[model samples]
Target: MVIVGILSIGFVVLAILLVLVRFVFDLRLTAIQQEADHSQLFRRKINHLRKIEQARHIRYLLIICLMIGIGLAILIGSFLVLMDKQQKLTAQNQIDHERIIYLEKQQKQLMANIPLKKYPEEGIGLEEYEWEKWSEEKKDVNLQRQIESAISKRSAQYFDSFDTKVSLSTPKTISLQLKGYTDDDASREMIKSNLDAFAKEAEKVSQLNNIHVRMITSVSKEKQVVYSVNYSRKKSEDKFNKQNVSEQNLKNSGEKG
Candidate 1:
């Protein structure tokens, strides 16, 4: 666009210069005619007037051409920009499609690795065991789904029994902490039983162990219960720490394995 604008301006300047040169030539002709006595001063003035009219016509034509050139330049530039944007959009869409396909393939592979339990429905199975057979990918998905389901179910059950509101935070490490009020020991025990059952069901489906249930209460006003479960994989540091302690004990007793 800028280049076209520059070219258009240059052409306009050239046209103006040409008109000026032609006017100067007409003046020279008038002078020659006057000196040669071939034409009177009035005739030379008339000729000069004719040249002015022609110059005006040329100037108008030049202005029209300049406007048309500028309009074309702007239009062409806009079209080029639009085409470039469309190409970028097309490329981005292709990239997104490929990424989606790759993720779907990854999901299928992970699901294949897990041991799926057959249900009455064909092509549909329940994840029955503690997701130990699942790959890291499948396990993560299963774990998140399980945790969310448990939280939703437990939260509803807790709220139903007590008029006091109960809110559940996001479950992390298979632990849920609840806060509310209970009528009596029976009510508290009921809530505890409900939470314990939920934890057991989760344990059956996921690789977790040693589920712990803890509750805190301020008399009848509020009560909070926390459920914690350990993932199946033990941390390397914990194992190493245990081994080191055992080795130290064995050395003190002068025994070796």
Candidate 2:
């Protein structure tokens, strides 16, 4: 750019000098021609006038060519500058596109790892995650049918102690609870064994569903148990009851106000 500017200045300076020289030369030649004509030297005056006109024309042509060259140089410089800027913009756009793709992929991985139960909101960012969970649930609908089929196939083996319940918390581990009624050690052992078999079947189904399975054996009071059962169900119910009462009181207070 600096070189182009310098060359442009030089061309302008040169053109100015050529014009000034031509003007001065034409002035001097016309003055000499007039002096010769006044002295009655017609032939010399005519020759001087003709030479001056020819030289003036040649200088005009040179100035026009120099102006054209300067214009072309400026045009070329402007084109180069525009092309450079365009290339930079294109490269930046490509970089931005790749960055966006990387961020989207990372977001997908994060959402996939987040449990549905832990999801905070139903917004654009979570839409794909919600859809995926919904699709998984749809596919898992056949799990019940598959379990029923397996139970029917083994109806004879568990006819005496076949009562069972399944609990599924979304995006969490799946649990299968088997009930035992008898107090006898043999009966408890048989229930445990049956629960294990059912657990294996549940595991197979879980594999298909891409979920974890937990087998839990629950016995009635008549059955002697080694481990104490947690009363969390009663605790949760109490908590819920208290929460509801508080909410009702607040609503009544607001109405009164």
Candidate 3:
């Protein structure tokens, strides 16, 4: 549009200049034709001079018009380039904003958890030592009591939430709702195996039964189950499964299996 507008304006200006040149030439020609003796000779010179002036004027106008068109094209192209850059930058800005929010949520969740007390991982059995710490934390944290007191209490305040439960039961079958971060077995098994191991050790734990372990995450306020497995007290073939905000069931607070 800009290019067309500029070219159109150049054409109009050229037409006006041509008309003015014609009018001047006509007046000069009339004067030259009036003389008697040298009328013919003067008329020829006037015609030649008019042609030269016309050529010079048209050339100047064409050059000016071409320069204007080129200027308009450059200006419009530069504006489009700026607009394209702005759009890409806006999209990148949005992605950065989302990433920041995700990191902040992770930080908050970490801050809410219990601080770690490092123990030897090589020689010492984890269950023998960790149970003392677990017992203290399980009793100390106000939220765990609420969950332990009643199995049905599904949610709790942030930081007040720890994702583990140990029970004394001798039932034919047991259901385990495992909490995990990823879909991989190493990641998912952290909670499931951790619970199963603890359950085996805990007083009157199931020995001969079908234990169903489910790996799930939180979606909105509800639990989203991602993986599931059914096995017996004796080792059995493993089978599959899931981001949750408020984590469920951890023996140690502030840490993930």
Candidate 4:
């Protein structure tokens, strides 16, 4: 498209140059004819006039060709530009569609495994170990208790709003919700900055509790912000399975004995 546009401009310049040259040539011929009146000069003048006329016609033809070339270049350039833009838009839409599908699948999985009061219309979602509640009868009882304590301490230090909810469960999942405003640019920046600070602060406590943190943020059309944090740790699959295998072997040996 850029090349075509440049070529179009070049043709226009060429046409202008041809017109100026023809004008000068015409003036020169008129002056020479006015100055020459001798018989020999009159014959030469007539022949020269015929040659000038032919040259003028050729110049006119060249200018017309240049004009047509310029018009075609412009038309082709515009078509190419529109086609390129359309292709880019189509690719972007496809990428966005794929991303949406992936996120929806993840959201469904989290909703199935975890209990939640509600889901946002649009936002990032992630899954991690649950650390909100501590259960005495559950495995890893000590770790669960420590995680709950850490979560409570961090929540109290960072957030005191009534809207904030810090809950711990048996598997040790910490669920936190923070309400924020985003009515303007300053408010939006404030929301973003506070969320970052809160996440980092919570994550610091999470590391001490030996758990992972997943932070999800959503914004509504009204510019309200919702930052949700899920903190949890996954039980070691290999160790648990090995322990079950060992217990079964011991039981079989006792029966044989």
* TM per prediction: 0.30, 0.33, 0.29, 0.39
TM-score of candidate 2 versus the correct structure, residues matched by position: 0.33
- The Cα RMSD of model 4 versus the native structure comes to 20.3
Encode model 1's per-residue lDDT on 84-126: one tens digit a residue.
Answer: 9999999999999999878755654453343322212221122
Estimate the TM-score for candidate 4.
0.39
> In candidate 4, how many clashes are counted?
13
- Worst ten in a row by lDDT for model 1: 240-249
Evaluate residue 188 in candidate 3 and report its C-alpha lDDT on the 0 to 100 scale.
38
Which candidate ranks first by lDDT, i.e. highest?
4
C-alpha RMSD by candidate, in order: 19.3, 23.7, 17.8, 20.3
Give the poorly placed runs of model 2, Cα more than 4 Å off. 31-38, 42-53, 63-67, 101-257
Q: Point out the higher-scoring one by TM-score: 1 or 4.
A: 4
Question: Per-residue alpha-carbon lDDT of model 4 for 1-257, expressed as tens digits?
Answer: 67777777777777777777777877766676666455876878666886878777686977768696876779777888899999999999999999997876565444334322111222111113343323335546666555545544434322322134444552333455443222244533443344344433334333222222222222333223333333233342211110111111112223311
| Cα lDDT over the full model 3 | 0.46
TM-score order, best first, reads 4, 2, 1, 3
lDDT at 204, model 3:
31
Better of 1 and 3 by TM-score: 1
Candidates 2 and 4, the one with greater TM-score: 4
For all candidates in order, the CA lDDT equals 0.46, 0.44, 0.46, 0.46
Candidate with maximal TM-score:
4
The better-scoring model by TM-score among 2 and 3 is 2
